[model samples]
Target: MTKKDDIVQGEGTKSGGLSRRGFLGATALAGIGGATGLGSLVMTRESFAAAAEEARNNYVVHPGELDEYYGFWSGGHSGEVRVMGVPSMRELMRIPVFNVDSATGWGITNESKDVLGHDNTFLNGDAHHPHVSMTDGRYDGKYLFINDKANTRVARIRLDIMKCDKITTVPNVQAIHGLRLQKVPKTNYVFCNAEYVIPHPNEGSDMENMENHFTMFNAIDAETMEVAFQVIVDGNLDNTDADYTGRYACSTCYNSEKALDLAGTMRNDRDWAVVFHIERIEKAVKDGSYKTIGDSKVPVLDGRKGSDFTRYIPVPKNPHGLNTSPDGKYFMAAGKLSPTVTIIAIDKLDDLFAGNLNEERDVVVGEPELGLGPLHTTFDGRGNAYTTLFIDSQVAKWNIEDAIRHYNGEQVDYLRQKLDVHYQPGHNHASLTESRDADGKWLVVLSKFSKDRFLPVGPLHPENDQLIDISGEEMKLVHDGPTFAEPHDCILVRRDQIQTKKIYERDDPFFASAREQAEKDGITLEADNKVIRDGNKVRVYMTSIAPQFMLTEFKVKQGDEVTVYVTNLDTIEDVTHGFCMVNHGVSMEISPQQTASVTFTADKPGVHWYYCNWFCHALHMEMVGRMLVEKA
Candidate 1:
């Protein structure tokens, strides 16, 4: 089937808009047949692309509002949600809520109606301490589904009224983390991962085994809120108890008592799973030097799938967030507690069922050398993929098309070498929403987790535990303003598009004069600014102001080559800055008082933020400027 056809099948629509069929396609099955035969499992590349295309059309690509950008804040003690406005990075709104244990994850259901006077879910409950990992899906744009860590229940929230409709408890589920809505035929189902669950030896025994049976996928019905199918992921089991005990012990076994302490005590003597690196344990076994003793090696119990769960895979850690590309051609999974993201060709899904999946087919993406942690991920319009970092509190943007192009040997490097890395400390779970500027260019917004530091008040407080700026090469600290105490999530809002005739007829004659003066001064134009209309075009000049930091802005018209001279100005604080236009295809960094120049034609016009690229400097928050580009 063609991509267009797949859209019809997956989204259940002929027109490129939301329909009952589109809702079904997004929530129900892509086609009628189930995964019964080998032919059904083996999907050709063309068919997969079609399915992805159909899924893409269901979403309405609205222009983003600069003022409606939603962000979450958690200051060690309390938490609130804040909306940031454009033109100026000011806080537009703040909804304060007290006693929030920890804001794990959040999602905006497209219900359009208000719930609890709010559309977002805080993911807190009575029995559980409100640990929500991730949330997704808006069936008929009314119901919001979230996975709760503390309760292991999938909370179905009514978005129109903004109230908790019902919480469906997943039986035998423990430490549930990520929740995703997968559309089957007629009904929409939820696929979730039960990260870890404690299994007792007999009944009320003190000993607990960190069982692998917890990692299973569940299919849920959206309308009725019922579970359709439950599938356990078990790869292979080769070695006997001795080999597994010595090799995979760290990955599997954990003291149930210790887990309770960290997570806080639970009601039912339930055992909590311990977190560890499984790949390291496997290496020790392969070398034949794995230590086996009463304490060294724990007994391996048969999981739900028998030995399938205990099998070893090339990827070294526990997989956390799992998602498919918009095109459904690739499946991506991240290793929990480790900084690696793995991409698997979906065509290989059948291998898992055949018991012949190869570890070499998986490509692991990581920057272990740089201490970056890859956590939750979401896709944007231009086929680019963005992943969040739990440890560093930053976002990494990867070019999926380029990665695939390089994988296909089309080019040695497929990415434009232009990376727009943004820094938002404590940035944990994130989602993407696209919007267009008055000029019709696409922009993406990122939500982050910003919280206040929890300081120890005793005399024994470590002096070495001071705050350090380490944003690294890709991202610079832009604004350290007190706008946020703890930002947990963010969503991009597109502003309404401005007509061409209205832009030229605006009352601001100063903007037009600035363009004429810059040209009369014998300055060559480079590009137009997106947020500002000082003039149609401005002259490019270079200056050296700060060491390893660049200070620059733009001037532009409807159509003209604009030049921006960037200089490194030496400021009072130790900070580095760089300039980049991700969509316009321009960027460079300069040293303090040093200068660099880049020229690019303003082919695409939109509002984009250019900020500092280095992690140094205390007032790093003050390093932000905007550009507004008009049509030529």
Candidate 2:
């Protein structure tokens, strides 16, 4: 018997009601010369450029800014979670992930109970951190989908109740690092990126037979709780082909020996004969890079053949996060290895699949201004996009519609400029929400690290410190208190209430103070924030409502050493409170009923929130608050 027949018989080829040798030969033929043929048919750059220009000429202005919300929720190392409020850019809330002990100030209480419940329950050896989160406004406007990487499970959280419910386990997968939800009118599919798998050590001896596999895609039926389809991007092709009465060839090396072995055994079977040699040719072509060919070489099943999949667009490296545009016209993917955001036109997917074999359809956004390292990104209601810069500990914004217009040939240099950069060093995941306070104006809530922390700059600049500042043209700092500890993941608490206010009414105090300081420093404070209409400035304060009692409010003119006084008014025992200003870099813990004061300098204006580091607070989900700072 030939080498292929020997291996097939050794593995009991027909025991499972399938002929292994026949299947391997067929697959080899289908994959040969497939990708190369696809690549040669793509549109040239000049054609794409002309098409882009034509698209702009026919473009019609949108009536109003897009009205969809984007959220970023990250897990923390110390069990603290935070969400960023986009556009306005502020902290929505910070909640504890574990319960703390009152006596020893060590050992969290009920360590298994996550703030969101069963869905967020701590695994056998797991701890709370902002691991993964998703949002589906259709299910419920105030609900968020989250996954605990440590536990390898998915769950749902209700923003209104701050509670979580465990969902079904994502089937046929392990180590889900990133996931995307595709809504197909009547059906919704969740595509999960599974763990990387290397070939078994023993397979190296038979390099031609060794297999390295990654879960290409898994289709889950949300309604039936069934795994509808599973595709292995890389696998032992013989296993699949055998069942189909086809032949497959080794993908590791291009040679006739492997092909001849299978062909000799399956020659008597017409179905097997057609499959074996065909697959061998395909495999030779794919593995050899089409450098050499023989008479046995045959065409393979390439999606790009005779299609428009030839166009190439750049995609970020190690894409771990993904989201689609509100209008479903665009899709965005975030890279983990490098700082890069890729935008893809969804309408082109079919064309991409048709001819662009080995080509990725995507465009790089904000490449020139900021170094790429985006971990997660979400869209705000006003056509702007927000992304978290993991390495920089900062959040960046982009105008999607403006970006598309630029990609499609519109020229707007200012829109191309990167306007806002909020530096919250050591920051992780974040989310955005739009709500109205008592004043009847839209408020952006951002959640982030509330501890006195610092990230290393590098060996050369070891002392370089970073802090997230939420102050900008369309952003401001509002309120703050002790409600977080190494805080990470957060999402906006969306509500239906609407409120409107005169813009200047919110800017007078900060503008006036900034103007005074700028004049003293021999600099001019720009006539911004409508200073004349409402007054010269605005008053901004933060209130904390957990672990103890405190309402910290102060004017920007007071300098950075703002004092916060705490009183123990609640009946709860052993409950202590503390406040830490991240940007100012100072913290103090206050005991119950006794007024204690802490002071820190606010050198920069941005959104900062505090959380209770004490135990037994994660269950309440009330250990944090919001603070907004402006140019003072």
- Candidate that scores best on lDDT: 1
Candidate 1 lDDT, 467-527, residue by residue in tens = 1111121111122233222233333332221111211112222123333544566543223
- Residues 193-274, candidate 2: write the lDDT tens digits: 3333333232345435423222323333343433333333331111000101112110110111213353442222111000
Q: lDDT per prediction?
A: 0.36, 0.34
TM for candidate 2 is: 0.40
Worst 10 residues of 1 by lDDT: 236-245
Model 2 residue 30 CA deviation in Å: 56
**Per-residue lDDT for 376 in model 1?**
49
